[model samples]
Target: MGNKNISMAVIRRLPKYYRYLADLLAKDIQRISSKELSEIIGFTASQIRQDLNNFGGFGQQGYGYNVEALHREIAKILGLDKKYKAILVGSGNLGQALTNYSGFKNAGFDIMAVFDANPRMIGLKIRDYEIMDSDLIESFVSENNVEIAILCIPKEGAQQVADRLVKSGIKGIWNFAPVDLDVPSSVIVESVNLTESLFTLSYLMKDGEEA
Candidate 1:
């Protein structure tokens, strides 16, 4: 099948591949042997060959692999080749922080638009983008070709916004609203509960940092 059907066990190895390739590329190393890669990534040489083989042939019997080529290949496999256009659905404190964060653009994501329900907040500029009312979400997404969205609205409005976003043709969602959402099989949603994460960390650190 495709990369989606790639098993989790194999998927876990992707970061290793990416990291080694990136490091080699930075050092201007044009090629790498599988044995060397295994030492760097802590995988067996056979495992490295098998992982690369599962995707496609990446090396030769005598020479080795082209480092730059492998880097480009892994990036494409992980959806980094094309920039992902996204929108922020809440335009609140957290949403505005995301808007101000310039780092996502470097990682192949661009927050092109933002939405809110309040009239006073709508049409105001935050960072480089202006906040638009959620009423125009469908048209905005269609016009801008936005494929992903980040939800930071209240828990009550979370599902409501998700429903609108599903109908708006968004392919993926990043939800921070403390609610489990229901979407189509075709759409992907990643939940990140910051409150819960901090609380969990606090409990683990209750005895004063890990020894």
Candidate 2:
């Protein structure tokens, strides 16, 4: 099946599967049955099977799945095998924390540079990268062939920055700003709203209390 035909729910679960498979590999586990994966991953065995089937079932009916091979396949499916040149558009607390995270680099997303509108933050070092002025973003992205952008700025300027990113050939955006961005259909955007997520958790807790 083509990726477009896959449900977003299945696509989101791919990362969880990849992570658990990697954990199993580290434990020196070799092969795993769908039921076995279900126990650890908290999904029903049938659900696991169906999810995997979306991208061509890799598990054998009797022999189950080879842990190493499954992990590699999931990595490729998630595009983790390819390297992405990315840039960060904010250098505030959240932005700095993201820069400090080594996981992004390990997963093939290299943050080539950081940009910020604040005058004080300009020229400041976040690890090896010195923060550049936001005005230079378009040129920098075009010149460096950046494919992804991580936006950690406030909602006020998020859309403006997104526009600049799209103009400069950014294919994907990992957005942390609370506001939704308006961009071309060809440009992919994944947004994380901390307040909204926390609010969801709060609502669930309230419902549990009322129940």
TM-score per prediction, in order, is: 0.79, 0.99
lDDT of 2 by residue, 1-211 (tens): 3599899999999999999999999999999999999999999999999999988999998999999999999999999999999999999999999999999999999999999999999999999999999999999999999999999999999999999999999999999999999999999999999999999999999999999
Q: Which residues of candidate 2, in runs, are more than 4 Å off?
A: none
**What C-alpha lDDT values do all the predictions have?**
0.88, 0.96
Per-residue alpha-carbon lDDT of candidate 1 for residues 1-211, written as tens digits (9 for 90 to 100):
5777678888777877887788888899999899998888899999889888878877998899999998998888777899999999888899999888887898789988899998999999998788898899888887877899999899998988888888878899999999999998899998999999999989889857655
Write down the TM-score for model 2. 0.99
Sum up the clashes in candidate 2: 0
What candidate 1 gets wrong by more than 4 Å, as runs, is 12-16, 38-47, 199-211
Candidate 1 lDDT: 0.88
Which residue pairs collide in model 1, if any? none
- Evaluate residue 98 in candidate 2 and report its C-alpha lDDT on the 0 to 100 scale: 99
Superposed on all Cα atoms, the candidates' RMSDs to the truth, in angstroms, are: 3.2, 0.8
